[model samples]
Target chain A: MRRLRSAISTASAEFQRHYAHNRRLAEELRERQERARHARPQRDLDRLERQGKMLPRQRVERLLDPGTPFLEFSSLAANMAYDGESPGASCITGIGIVSGREVVIHADDSSVKGGAWYPLTIKKIVRCLDIAIENRLPVVHLCDSAGGFLQLQSEVFPDRYMGGRIFRNQCILSKLGVKQLALVFGHCTAGGAYIPGLSDYNVIVQGTGAVFLGGPPLVKAATGEEVTVEELGGAAMHTSVSGTCDYPAGSEEEAIAIGREIVAQWDRPRKWDCQREEPEEPYYDPDELYGVLPDDIKKQFEMREIIARLVDGSRFHEYQPNYGTTLVCGFANLWGWKVGILANNGVLFNDSSLKGAHFMELCNQNNTPLVFLQNITGFMVGRAYERAGITKDGAKMIMAQTCSRVPKFTVMCNGSFGAGNYGMCGRAFDGRLLFTWPNHQIGVMGGDQAANTLAEVKLKQMQRNGEAVDQAVIERLRDETRAAYLEQLSAWYSTSEIWDDGIIDPVDTRNALGMAITASLNAPLGESGYGIFRF
Target chain B: MALALLLGAEAAGIEIVRRRPHLVVRIDGREHEVVERDEADGRTRIELDGRPLALACAADGNTRFLRLGGRNLRVSLVDPRDAAAAGEGGGDEIRAPMPGSVVTLHKAEGEAVLRGETILTIESMKLQTALVSPRDGVVELLLRGEGQTFDKDEVVVRLASPSAPGPSEPAPPEPATAEASPAADAKGAA
Candidate 1:
């Protein structure tokens, strides 16, 4: 219960510099979000309005409870994909409260490319469904997509996690007793038709909404049958004739109102309430987190200072505080939910690896959730450390962490390389959620280190082959490899690939973690046990 | 009505016996003079029988941990019904719950100390874990101290049974004075 005696100098020059840099970064993030939100072309909005249909965003606004928060995911998805054409992947996904129940909202951005499912659009949709499944929250699909983007079907249609996985996830969700309501506002043709077909409830708008395996043009092409879209699969036909949809509405407003009423009829869930003290502002300003993280990934900063700014009231109960020098393990409250924190202060040596293993087990035993703050260069590897069985020690940690039943969250605060990524619950470990900061980078090793190591290998090979060891060739190799590493290691690149949930601003870490933790409580804690250690 | 508390394994009956002219608390069977000396900024300073003790106490539900004398002591307010349901056991010797290296010892072997007095400090994961005495008695053996590493549940200190003194028993020395020790530095740092 000890309130941390802060060692950070809040007013120091370094702190001020960090605060200024972070403030600018936060501003840039806001600008990007604003631009992405407003990027829809004016013509598309007018066209939807002319057709007596509401824009995707307008539907979401009407569906959610008034004045509630909406935590959007990948707002800039497909920004770089589709040759920079698809804005927000031509779709919108977020968590918002509707009918006083937290639900995942998946809306189609018809303004972009006629709401076609680009490769990135499929990705964004799948990710949102994954969130719905994990949190056990009901999903409301604002289905208006124009099927798959034919120009890039190669990328969208043939992968395990692509177009087909959408229906697969919906089936899994239904099996788990989670509910879904589909509001069809526009055409859902071909593969997209299954969105409403698989949902537990479907509401279709009369004029624009259609659900069919093949649209009218496709039907004409396949069988030379000329039929109108409304006669083939419109709201009236589906609700009365085919019985495919549950509710039929005359307009967009009527459809959303019906969706809200249906959600209210469903049983309310008993929210998980964690044992906690009243929430308090952190003793130290979270802004200081900017100053605490070094601009250069190679440099080190005190992790406790960052923890002080993230936890409730900056209070912590450190477990086994002194022995493991490179790792800090303790328990703190994030938004009043108790979480066991394992943050790296430096590289993982034998002692730190063992400490991590022990701390993870303790958290699981206590039914506390885990949060990993990773800024690591990987496990210590040298003659002295190898002699101490560092590899086996690291394996023990990985074994324990992999088997832990409690939910885990991770943040790549800075450098994440090699085995350190696995040890810290990186992408491979299936943490409930993972995020990266703008300055964060991840690779098998640092760019400079990888460049130097590869260059050395090539130079030695040239010597052995009795060839001229040109310094120019070696320099070019290093530069090329370093550039390639930097490109792949950027947070934006990782986020575009869905390597993490999203890239969050450093200052928004508290709220983001709070929301994530709350959402994670949808599932009960699993039984505690871990794999056998290597001794 | 009475309540029992288990502070790091030692059970005690605590009751507010009197509240006039300064609060009096009965710990176990003895009444001690107590008062809230000062309380501000999450820290509480209390005078126990004339000796001032400063603590930073945080309550999580019914379980509270007090950071006193440089140690985080998990204090649980036990329900008398539950305590009577579970039969008592014995682990008279002090043991470590996790593996760690002993940092510093405030007293030597065979030194007499009061219940709840910190015996030594152990360092693990950059945290100093204070090893406190569960009962007032002579320290019959200081198993591990000062730079020595020990495993989980390994005894670090042992107290003589209240009646029979162990072998090599030294006369119970006067209780160690607080003014000359470094433990004073731990007051209110929480």
Candidate 2:
């Protein structure tokens, strides 16, 4: 073996220029994350304090063990939705250790619009619960919501991944013996009451907590009984008279303490015994990644350079270095976890596609997880590539990825376009988790190429219809379509639409992948198979 | 099981032929006694041919990297059949696998080179790859020099096998290496 000699001059002008540019992008990411965390108005904070209730984040802090890592998801969800009204999707969800057990916490941010279940809020809840089931993690729900917002019920009520899915996932978790605890700190009206009722354990705060299919107003309208709020469904009645709740607490703190005790009783689930070594920092300064990373999507950068910054000790064992040059296939350690990496250096050629499929199958057979670093224009086009069976090769890669039993993680490192997205485990592929860098762009094609294609179509359509083709009209249409496509392709926009789990800082990539892989180990790897090859 | 060793850009077949107290490994048909002298804190101390080699070995997911003989190598263990299929080409002209700038010229024209000796260094994305000789040969043409750039698959150097014909190109012009400034930020490296 030989020491990998680095040829980069760190202090060169070219390196400095790229460093400055990427540093600015990293700063921008920090600012956005900070803003999202504190988006609620000051008035709301004062109101919550005056009400003698802890903030949702404070409740989480009290529930989780001190010094444990809390990997929050979608902290800025719905940032581009709800016309700037909802922030953090009006709820907070994450994986945290509570009483020594790793549990998924879905705490509603009651500070924002009474922590109502907006469409995005429902989506976030369902997504978190799905993670809970897949990873065999228990769930702790901090119930403080006004139930579903009636105005947007249509959008959230009927979808397969919306309102009903949240309860469905809860049922699945219970059937699998994954525990759940609900701390009822606020109103649990209508469909929301099922949250606490269905949980394995429920702790209700005396005066603040209430649960019922219908609130006092709806109850009064339906029946002439005129029962008081306390008698109808308060913590006292539910805990003492009815068997709806397991524990009764005087305050939020007491309720959290009770919730912690319940979680402490459940045994920690088994995790896969993956081969591991003590983690080491990558040999290169991760900050140097800014210097080597290309700002332009068209620019070529060695995928190994980025991999060097990510894997432990920057020691990578490239799998097939020469056979498929366009796609770099290799194995590296991410936080001491072995992962098979397939990164794109250029458009996917026939050989590169076959290499990807082959690597995926190997990883599956070895029972190792995969990480895909995508930066592709698409599979190669033209007659020479077509004759090489590019389509068959791409299909083989997709099939291999589809049947892979090991966990798959995707990072949209750069431009993700066309069928390359599917081949690389896009949103539609159901990878355990997918994240994007703020500078990433995704579309069926690039904005310029898409505009040109549409413009050509419009010209042909006009000529066929016998209408005189107006050059100005065609130009206007191209610009309009290009602008819209560019906006849609942006990472921020994609995250808002839930196309990815979240938009992350480029530097946080290593830790995020580590957390995802660790959580995935809770479930055993399934068997693997694939479709017949087209050839 | 066999290991597929990607030594630089070439893949070679490796298998464990014997193991008693430790292991005897065969790499490209050559056998060596390999033993783990010490293992702790993610680093492995291995002895090959009775020469003590201290290397840092980290396993993340399925990827493994080994630091050996002052070089960092990323190695993948693969099925032996795939390794057998990865035979080296017998071309005289060596080309750039990807677009990059030449960083170092390890040998000059007419220099006798052993197989696997570093021929030239190309930097792409700030990572340097050392192109090594495929067989015992004499440098026929060294077209690229330090700081000269080349595109993917472009012929950058040529080698004359022991029994091959003489060089077609005449004596090379002496170009000052390392004196050429990087063209632009985009053209500096990959």
Candidate 3:
């Protein structure tokens, strides 16, 4: 038995040696083929890639491995031209390895007609996509296009019958199983925005970048809405409202950082568990909101300041900054799914702000949860009225406030009075829940206004009595009495009868809100895909 | 069935004519009496529900284009689908689906067209129908005369259809968003 075991061991060692030698020889053969491929003169490829005109190779080199690389399918392609210099066709697509794993990169050359999608570039883009399908690789598009080249595009597609069909033809490609991401640092507008919107995520910088569907010139002819280039299409537009883009950073470096982080985190899509269902704060102190607001309710403060305090530390995206300046509407996270909010900014009062009400109303129509900050010095009072169309705007705001389906809550940080109060979800309104600070006041006017009015009335009565009364002392007395009445209204069975749900402590405002919002009838509970809108 | 030549063609579930078409068409699955006479020239008088339904068309031999109100019709000597499909070996023919001008041709003649390959775009009523290749095939023809409108169902090109199985192709998944269909009237148009 011992002699048989020794013979078996010797035979196994010889077999192992043969197997290792064969694997080494196969590896050597692969290296020889690689060398031969490199040795073959590639004048056309080298000429097309002269100077830094085409960055497909460089992009792959920086993004993936330079030597240990995967083969690129369409390294050199001519657009429209059957044979000739098509100028690298705006977009260059190829395969490469990232961390030894294959990935497809389609890098647009801004040098090529400012990276426009003339009819020539369209097919070039499809070339990369086909490669993605043939070899299941994630797609990374480095886009910096000005927009569709209408003039060149017209010259290219001579077929009169198939005009704009080319533009909408990419509907199915977007749904294909490719992990897509877009990086925009240059002019991305009009048709340019479509590619980014279709991608899984987009990273953009603030100052150096911009994005919009149809630029200002087109917008002017269509809608007559005038604004600066950046104002019309900026980081804020995509990140907050349209939900077109996922990340917005201040600089290119920041955008790259965010992109890197996103790539690291992006595992195949999974259901996010909102396990921390607790509200950010408790409902004990409504007065804690007062700390965020200025001491005097009559003195207006930015509602955003209050919102910052209420939301989970900087978890909000406010949209339409210039369109509706007064009332701020944005998408924010309470636990997981985004909640839409439209709150009144107490300090800023103009036609701009009233317009914000109508905009917020639109958000309401969409069934996003709203939060209204109470404190506005009433609507604008001046020639600023008729010119800005504040009347139609105000009515629209009221109708929007009336027709909301999502749960709404309001905090009376002070100054919940008049028309502004109704617009900001005052306790008297149909807001889901209303809370107030200890210094809460809900009346036709502020305590200061009431004090002045009452002091004059009392002084006149005293004068009629022919009794001694100091004007200064009477003013002080009136003010003190007015303040007492204001407090009394927020107390026990007064506001409790109708105006308020409950009062919470100042410090517990965030927790209280989290509780109210998480506990309140959460709305927008419906199947996804867009349905018919009454608008 | 004692069929009028026009009615006979329609009974076979086929359309041989379009513009100023001579064939009888079934609407709501019912046929109405129509007369074609020429006062100055030979034109058709369309009568339905005991009333004259307007029938107008521009015509020539081998093809006559007709329009009765918004309904469009075209008459042809041959079946465009069969002619194109037969050359392509029983694959869906990528044709000018609508009467519109072609804007661009993405591929050359004899090139293979994959499913969903954008053959060309057609511009009609300021809207474009991206004429995509319905199946994988080697292009047999590329009739991309940009800026010229062709009648609906007109043969634009033919492809030698691919032998292997094609990609998942889209049929009529959805109609134009603006096209008012009876099923969806939940909200007034924005």
TM-score list, all predictions: 0.75, 0.77, 0.31
Between 2 and 3, whose DockQ is larger? 2
- Model 1, chain B only, scores a TM-score of 0.43
Q: Considering only chain A, what is the TM-score of each predicted structure? A: 0.95, 0.95, 0.40
Instruction: Sort the predicted structures by DockQ, highest score first.
Output: 2, 1, 3
Please report, in order, the local distance difference test score of every candidate based on alpha carbons: 0.79, 0.79, 0.51
Q: For each prediction, how big is the interface RMSD?
A: 11.8, 9.8, 32.6
Question: lDDT by residue for model 1 over A382-415, one digit each (tens)?
Answer: 5667888989999988987888888899988887
Which runs in model 1 stand beyond 4 Å of their true positions? A461-470, B1-22, B25-190
Per-residue lDDT tens digits of candidate 2, residues A177-290? Answer: 888999999888888999999999999998888999998889888986688778888988999899998899999999999899899899889999876778888787777878
Candidate 1 lDDT, tens digit per residue, B64-90?
989875778999888653455244322
DockQ of candidate 3?
0.00
Least accurate 10 contiguous residues by lDDT in model 2 chain A: A1-10
Q: Which candidate ranks first by TM-score, i.e. highest?
A: 2
Per-residue alpha-carbon lDDT of model 2 for B129-183, expressed as tens digits?
5566554567988888899887756888788865765454332432211111111
Range of the 10 consecutive residues with the lowest summed lDDT in candidate 3 chain A: A1-10
DockQ of 2: 0.06
- Fnat computed for model 1: 0.06
